[model samples]
Target: MPTVTPKTAGPDMSSPKTQILAALRRASWISGQALADAAGISRAAIWKHIHALRREGYTIQASSGRGYRLEHAPDHLSPEGVHAGLQTELLGRNLICRRSIDSTQNLAKSLGRQGAPEGTAVLAENQTQGRGRRGRSWASIPHGVAVSLILRPKTSPDKAPHFPLLAGTALARAVSRVCGIWPGLKWPNDLLISGRKVIGILAELEAEMDRISAIYLGIGLNINAEAEDIPPDLASVATSLRIQAGRKIDRLDLVRALLEELEAAYYAYRLQGFGPIREAWKEHNITLGRQVRISSGREIITGTAVDINEDGALRVRTEEQELVTVSAGDVQLCPAV
Candidate 1:
């Protein structure tokens, strides 16, 4: 039996199991009597929480003499695990961890409306009704990173549209740093590794006139999914960090890194403006200076993506020598002439 470590508890973290895990995290194991005394609960109560933790995919080894040791941590995302080594001030200050949910975005939006604090993170192990852009179904995976964040920025609602682009920039940097694999950014909100999609981001604004009440930023990153786990249609287009890196990445570590990067990027935007974010996005993006086709509603325009403007819109030099700035569209690299 391991005793829970004592740390600053998070909101809604009053459960006995959370405390027990915190204690176990501090060390491999403690005596059963020690755990009971530390948690101020009986040995039977400690055993009950231990059983629940095991059910959630944690491999705890309990012996008559050796007490309990954490042989293996859970593959699934737990708040205790994610927050264990998190390094951030505002971002992920309060985290909502769920075993299964319809969508993190939905819950995040609900929480935002209810005035959830800024930087509150909603994470789910599995999302049954996840969504991408244009109401497309986001494919779910067992060990994927499905998280949504709530941000209340002081900027105008006009800047709301650029949040997704900012997210893409942060995401690429985080992945590159954590997994040691550099990913290229597609226009707006897609991350590709070796020209295959690995992450998708969506940002929605809840605004009142010119003021933005909250921004619900949802991100889905393929971390440890096997090839067979991907859909037939997506096999050629999608990939996971595990598949690319040839090893399973620790989701908790990745999550912490991503949140830190995102927070830094957001703060930079507020303090310095969008110039730094735009520049970073350009450095990692694969769409610029490439022959491209943009599909916006009923019209299709073919051009060369030359630049992204200050407002985060894509600037294209069309085939006819005309310049067009596209604020929203699906961009595709055209076949070389």
Candidate 2:
């Protein structure tokens, strides 16, 4: 794994509730007095903080004599939850958590326009109007990870199209670290396991004439959904981490890993160049060296995926022995006849 020197400590953790939660995680049980002393507050204030944590879905058990025990933490994505173990410099430093939202991407874009910092992140538990590539609707349910990151990279506008590939590579690395299963990447912005889509990424760019202003990278990952949670129409083509791993996954861990990996990848691209990312993406991609059919506008071209160029264009070797570079399209792996 690549590493970057962190400019600042990840996520803010000065809140009383966050402090109490940290204490609960450190020991089996903590006395109210002890928590208050640790948090520099009175026992009554500690009780109030504990009550707030419980309302936020933390399963805290209180004994007659013993103080409190954190029995379970909900799988939902929260700022405190993700910040507890997040290790990153730029990404996810200014985090926002919402229970329900129209879309994380929209909010992130709005923040970007208002001069939000480079590492600002917006995470939503449920996205009512999520979107995917080609104007398709992306469904986000509870327990899934729906996040949008605001990145202001110092690069040209031509390089904006490759942001999705960079994000996909980072996500693949994070998933492999968490679930022990390495997912294959489809061209553009999809992660597949057992030939079913599990992750989708969309990159929207705000650019000037020559320089790129900001890139809002939106990612939707299906973490703990069951088979019934998937729509009937997409059941055959989609899956969740729980279905693939046969157990529930911790969303906070996945989110932290993702932010760390993304920070590393993004800085690598900015400082070193795209050589490392392109190679890493190729190692995990299922598109190259396969027979694929690309639908670009009115033309459907069937060919062997030869390579992806530096600008992230897919080069296809067609039946006519002509090599064509496609900038954007829908790719499908063609079965051998």
Candidate 3:
């Protein structure tokens, strides 16, 4: 079963409470009869919704005769709300939302194959089966940024790996811009904040073995969730923007900025090749010039990221006097190195 995101603030929009609140917002002094009729629910249901909305920080005025008045509504995640918060045309032109999903990336891939445009986006409040690189799980903290962008690129299959690196870099830039914290790229797709994992990105592409069809880029960031909110396994490593910025950020605003950066970085990557994107990636990369270990399949290669190559591969100069290019691997830093 798909996970249902608990309503930490307001009631889920799909719930009857939101219907009551929305009705109140639509008209003042909404009579119980009117509200119930409008919502197609019982009068008792109307009262329940009113009480629930009030509990969720909605300022609802109630009167014996005048019925109910909605003074304020809890912020909603409407596409119009998110897009209005955005200033670019590259990230969220088309949006799809699900209450629960196995994975937003899988959903986005389905959309991409059906000819969803370049900026098509799929977002879920929670994921039942969210994943990261190498098929590892990414714990989706409810109300954070769990998004998948489906893009149909004009590039070949061999160059697809570079997109993950570029996407990771774009996310780092977006987080820095919104939260005012400098994050580092661990490799192709991990965001480190204060030397701990804060974000996970996974890139999946559909191809005909040699030609590319579409790419499903997934990014999951910890936001608003407290330190204790992280699971026991990730608590020691993963961090959230709220934890770092000292406040809950407006997710809509941050998402807008992230998509803009992704679009621009993707454009640059296609136009000028990975050289320029690599430079941008290196500037925010903490692994560069630092001692690190790369785990590829089974063998472990330790070295410094003297440079990232034109193809987005890491060029590590090992202590064994071997300069190795690892296309895909797990990166780690030796303690004290």
Candidate 4:
């Protein structure tokens, strides 16, 4: 049996508590009978949902004759909150939220194998074994955002590597919009806030020869964690939105913004190709004009980061003035000589 996870907020629009919360968000008195009629449930069922909402940190006022009114709602990310603010055509149409999970990518891949539709997403508050590029483990705090989006693109397998770069571009835009500070991208999929990493994107896919089956694009974003919350080894390099912005952020709002931007970028990539995404990427990228070191397995290359090709490969000008196109590598910015 799968572990039972608790949900502080969720995307299930049909839950009675979710419906009650939605109605209560209007800040007006809603009678029990009216709620029951709207929700298509009995008065007792509404009371049960009211109790559930209270447990979820909703301040609701209930009286024998006056009915119920919402005093305040918690800022937790819930299915109702995500749905209420969502403005996308496809992405996040089917969402699953978990309080704790091993990894949203694994869950999303399983769902994809089971014929889950394109734009299906899985979100988790805590990832026990979140993964990063090159099979490294990702550290996800309770305040972090870990989500995986499932897609079935008609593009060939050669375009697989560009997915994460597209995601990074979308993430940078979303983070900038929500935090009021523009984030810079480091090569393919890392977003840096104030020269420290705050977001990591990982994309995995299944394909047959040249045909593609599905892609699971995952993101781990540090939202509200502070410096001390990060491990000592990463304390200096890892930072969160709360740390960088000096204020707590609303995760639900950020999630909605991120999904909207991601959906728009994904659609544009499918319809208009990578031209728009590539330009936007270069605009937000910090690596293009810097001296850099790239590690590709046993070989290490030191050069000046020059450009990115149409296929999303990084172009590096070596000391010998030779232009090398790197498909994938661990890129590190070096001080100018």
Candidate 5:
């Protein structure tokens, strides 16, 4: 029987799978002889693998005329498909995906605590108890993206706050590549589209007083959610990419791009720190010049959003000309009065 990759295990990751998927993408149908040559397997072996894939829900149309073609992929999200889609190294090397879960973030944290390697990823097709920053309820409709990543870096624990900033930059790049639309970063980790909330990122850090240990960066993106699927309360505040782009998208493609984007940015961050990504983030940020009222811990401060500090904190210049650095806070963009 073909093995079904665990939700925590992303894709097959075998070199042969990559070659086969790439060939299938280029040509709809190919002869078994050609497949065997490309995959470097015997014709009989190819037949065996094909049968196994079929049992695993892959629709490989086989006949003397058509040879073999992918008619329907399993309604399931295979780690192999995800691995084939993600043409990167290290980032998605450890993948755990679930068909339905309460929270990928929770699962990711458990895995992270167990010393999961860098680039460990957790994905779910549906999250029953998804959470955004500050315990905000996140919607996880079928086929929407609810993912969490575990990053164990050797950076200062103080600098862990910037992980979300880096993630926001990566997300902007990812969304732009797929949707052909520019998304703006708000302050720390919120991805906004036309002043509305489209993506929310929660960065959970586990560390001591001095150095940091690990960071769990969970991202909740509104992908293909119908307007009606959104909660009535968030109807005015939230929007989906499909609703914004006026079309459906290939989830696998977007996931692949996002993982690769995160990988590249993360590599740079660990190598040279947050210089380049921070600069890029500043360029695409919409909150810098706007008026924002921040709810920090208990005290709320209202001011003109000037810039982010080097430590990745939100800086607000108040009416009294005092600038304060906000380490962690909930942001509320004050409407024009």
Candidate 6:
């Protein structure tokens, strides 16, 4: 991840509630008058905001002389909670968080059509109609991470296929930083730890013949789920950070780290091109140099995974000494016979 200045880091301070929270965080307690002056709001408005924060699960203590003190903050992923200490340039600045939604991708696409700015994000605690590659159903538990990002990049439509690889590399870096365990990238957009799937990425694009309009990148990561939370059909193939680490992980910290890393990757790609991201992806990749089978539509190709090209296509060396580039497919590791 690229390093940013303090000016561009941390939560947006323009929000009155965020400003008050920052003030309170700076000190043990803040006087009502002082908070009002700092927030540029009246004392009554300050009180009202304080009440709203309390309703959102912040334990605030009030006293006649001490004013207001923050006792505790819940672990919820509300907009206010996520913005408390989040550091990013554009991503997560304009965020929409929900307790439950049908799909973050759907909401993100809808927002994109409405001319939502690039770097807008939609997050949900649970997704009822979550989807994966090839229109497969994705199971989303409440403890997992379900978020979609809307991006408008000034690039050609031909480069859109590389977005998933970009997202996967960023996610791998973030998970390694937060979980203390490095995950291997399975070609295209899956992250695996201990040979089990931990994260999946999907990218939907809107484009014309030559120009690209919007890209909605959806990411689902298993953060704090247990073995029992895994669906029966997916039990053998899916795993979570908690199951692997043997301890619960903080979702808010992980989400913040993800946004920051993603922002860095996005800017790097825009300025420096896909060379940096491709190298990073290769460093953590597990598919290359292995024998595999890929199913693209009704055709099946069995070959040795050779490399990924600049356009994010998987290069494979078939048994007949044929080198093929696959742009879309479902991959499976073939057992050596």
Best by TM-score: 2
For 1-337, candidate 2 gives per-residue lDDT tens digits of 2556545472243465766777788899999988897677898898788788899899999986998999999877777777664677778878999989999999999999999999999998899999999889998854798999999999899998779999989999999999889899999899999899999999998899999999999999999899988888889889998899888888888998899989988988888777778888998999998999999999999999999998998999999989999999999987656
Off by over 4 Å in 3: 1-76
TM-score of each: 0.84, 0.90, 0.77, 0.87, 0.89, 0.90
Sort every candidate by lDDT, greatest first.
2, 6, 4, 1, 5, 3
Quote model 1's TM-score. 0.84
The lowest-lDDT stretch of 10 consecutive residues in candidate 3 is 1-10
Candidate 4 residue lDDT tens string, 1-337: 1111222233333566556666676548889888887667898889888888788888889888888988876766677667654667678868898888999999999999999999899988899999999999998865888999998999899999889888988888788889888899999889997789999999998998988899899999899997778888988778999998989988887998888888878877877788888988998999998999999999999999999999999999999999999999999988666
Report the lDDT tens digits of candidate 5 across residue range 190-283.
Answer: 9989778888899988987777778888988788777788878888888888888888866777888888888778878766777777797887
- In model 3, state the lDDT of residue 63: 90
Clashes of each: 6, 0, 0, 5, 12, 0
Which window of ten consecutive residues has the lowest lDDT sum in model 5?
1-10
> Tens-digit lDDT track for model 3 on 201-311?
888878887687888889887877887787888777878888988998877668767877887787776667877777788878877787888889989898877878878
lDDT, each prediction: 0.84, 0.87, 0.76, 0.84, 0.79, 0.87
Q: After superposing candidate 2, which stretches have Cα over 4 Å from the reference?
A: 5-14, 26-45, 62-68
Model 3 CA RMSD to the hidden true structure, in angstroms? 8.7
Model 4 earns a TM-score of: 0.87
lDDT over C-alpha atoms for residue 76 of model 1: 69
Error of 6 at 228 (Å): 1.4
